[model samples]
Target: MEPIDDLVGRLGRWSAGRGPLFLLLATRLRQLIDDGVLPPGALLPPDRRLAGALAVGRTTVVAAYDTLRQEGRVVRRQGSGTRVAPAVPTPGPRVAETSNPLFLHLLDAPDDVILLSCAAPLGPPPELTRAYATMTLPADDLGYHPAGLGALRTAIAGRYRSQGVATVPEQILVTTGAQQALSLLTRLLVAPGDGVLLEAPTYPGALDLFREASAGLLPVAVGPDGLDVDAALRLMERHRPVLAYVVSCYQNPTGAVLPPLKGRRLVERAAALGVPLVDDEVLADLTLPGGDGPAPSPLAAYEGGSGEGGVIGVGSLSKVVWGGLRVGWIRGPQPLIARLARLKAVHDLGSDVPAQLAAVRLLAGFAPVQAARTRALRTGHDHLRAELGRLLPSWTCPPAAGGQTLWVRLPYGDGVSFAQVALRHGVAVLPGRTMDALGGSGPYLRLHFLLGPEALTEAVRRLARAWEEYEPQPAAPHAVAPGAVPAIVV
Candidate 1:
């Protein structure tokens, strides 16, 4: 049995984040269990004893324990009391082994290493700073806004409406980021053993989340144009997935934009099949110079205003404005939005109020911000491509129309092993396997062009060195055809 004093000590600063007290307690307890600090089958302190030690009400402790029990993390009986659940084999990668290298760097990284693993702006734009400067908060209202501030929600809805999606404020539910929006939707729609349709080389974060839910992943190939709608529909009809997630515009890793005709066909088919489609448009606004005119209307635009069939659109400012700003939203039917808001409230009560206020201002004057971002991105993208072509001419690096990454196919070896070599050579890159659901992208690597020209050049030099050191391995049998993965022209 874990000692009450030691357990309390392990849960240091647990109450720092917002949300219900029980949720905070449960979150801390979950961490301890996952870390094996509280070993499997270890008995926990009685609710009253823990409550007394943590200086909280017994009910809070009880609710926390109940939450854990619901997650199957603990087993409780009247006579035997609560004990940590015995370890069991689970689907997908362990929580400790995050697929995104950015997370690993966040925890710890060497100072000299050039990070090409995560594709994000180097710094917040001037517009973000200006937005923060002029932002004001409400004095009379309590800060909590589970569904987000009304003004911000209105702004988000208006943005969607302007893009041809007939959205109202009632359809918007603001979340911490697109990541949380996905998490909340997964909780609501996906159950253990349920099937989820995903693009083959999708966002690593989404793959991680679905895997954590123990959802069976169905991988559909995505090319330069976008998701293989025919393959996706065939799988939907055969497997009847509970949910389908797609990055409709400027997809992560691949940087593929779904053609408008295909987008319409996909939503229409998904509606007919009764599968809730989640359109992740976090990268939609990241259009580079000399690329496609503008990202096509969001997937929701294809689904009529009836809102009966699910075509949930998720958007975020993390990619366009800044990652630290942490403002994102979900556009769905009114009922779905309302339910998601309740789920979000249980997680964080609400997103940062000041951030929401600033987001409103940012959206109001977004033209210049977007223009500036695309210009910088275009420069970075061109510079990175040139360096790669000159330094490692053998590798097949396709040009992306938009988005931060370039999906490069290795000349011979797999990405997983080469990634380790790249890290040792002072550059970090994401292995294609981590982003792939079926491990068919072994011959590929997703490299970001977010760094400055000098840094990108240095990173490419490091990668070239790593390539020389890395021994060539025979291509994996499951590797997809290089011809199928083309660059996004528009």
Candidate 2:
């Protein structure tokens, strides 16, 4: 299984829309083995690891392995892991090779393949390296700060104060990243089966965490103007969700910044309904310079009268600094922060001390890093928009006001199928379905403009080739018979 684990993620694109997920995965594995792409006796990755990579439920991987065993295509030993059966019979008829984008991205591409999935900046700002050189941790002290280092906490609190929201060091709890902050909040605020509201196409990572908590979802649609204040109010009143999560600043997938008025109203309405709101600000400072002027104050700042609002804020250095820094903080009422810190301690004890020191240094000297990142993002945004217009004229790609991606709509064909074709052209793009909470992300795909101008040009060129070569999926048998009429199922 040395290299097989690396190959398991490639199965995702091919597994899309093809019967039962387990069967599709199993059949694809069989095809690879029969074609000698996976030679006889090749070891398979552990089911759990493969499941994590695919972003599928582990049970899917378990069932797939079971199906392969039943077909006599793979063998599972008591002590060792699964392996392809030796001298496998040839597959019947020549099944067409999978056109999955991930398959090609993983197995076919060379070192220079373009990336459109990740929105992370390439590296930390130069100031970070210098900051690390001058910063130091206490040599004699044991390094455990569950609520984060005092200096870092003070620095982060100062950021909130600068934004008009008065915060103290005690109100901030640092976690490994914004993801961990979400996890901690989910566990603290949501009970199993509790109703949770979110935007229709919010951050997929947040959706995954809520799903993992078994929270019932109430999705409100978001348009180009960001979360609809009216729709959010309606959903809040109707569903009575226990908690609602929103990305008010430079929202993900859509790259739509919430209008200040709408953001204020949404927070007020949620507070009126007694539902707590979590505002993810990981992409807050990434506002494209000169476009929106400046990012509006966080939703929590809208709390008027009596000082207590339902809003809780989460911030991270990952998007503004480098993702590798692994520094993020949760800002909420002191009581919530205390409870969350207890839960966070149980989860991982504490985040890295050195990274926290680095973050503190970066925050102290953030002006230059912010300028550099803004320049990079603005360049990427312009290049991507220009290329899409030149190469994909029929496709509608809205210009991003801020944030790292352009949410594009295809004039024809499904994003899933188009993604498979794109993979073959040496470009990898995420289909829209991955971002949908209610599985309504049809006809859309998200493309990150984080790459440089040259790579963006080449990537779009590859995408155009893929678009030309893409064939519409053949109609499935379930659609209709020759003269049969459709009937509604009750």
Among these predicted structures, which one has the highest lDDT?
1
lDDT of 2 by residue, 29-136 (tens): 654444233445768888888888787889988898898888887899977888887763345522234343444444454676676866788877788888789877
Q: Alpha carbon lDDT of residue 50, candidate 1?
A: 92
Show the colliding residue pairs in model 2. Answer: none
Question: Please, what is the TM-score per model?
Answer: 0.78, 0.75
By summed lDDT, the worst window of 10 consecutive residues in model 2 runs over: 481-490
lDDT of 2: 0.75
Q: Which candidate wins on TM-score?
A: 1
Poorest 10 consecutive residues by lDDT, candidate 1? 481-490
> Which segments of candidate 2 are over 4 A away from where they belong?
1-112, 305-308, 471-490
Clashes of each: 0, 0
What lDDT does each candidate get? 0.81, 0.75
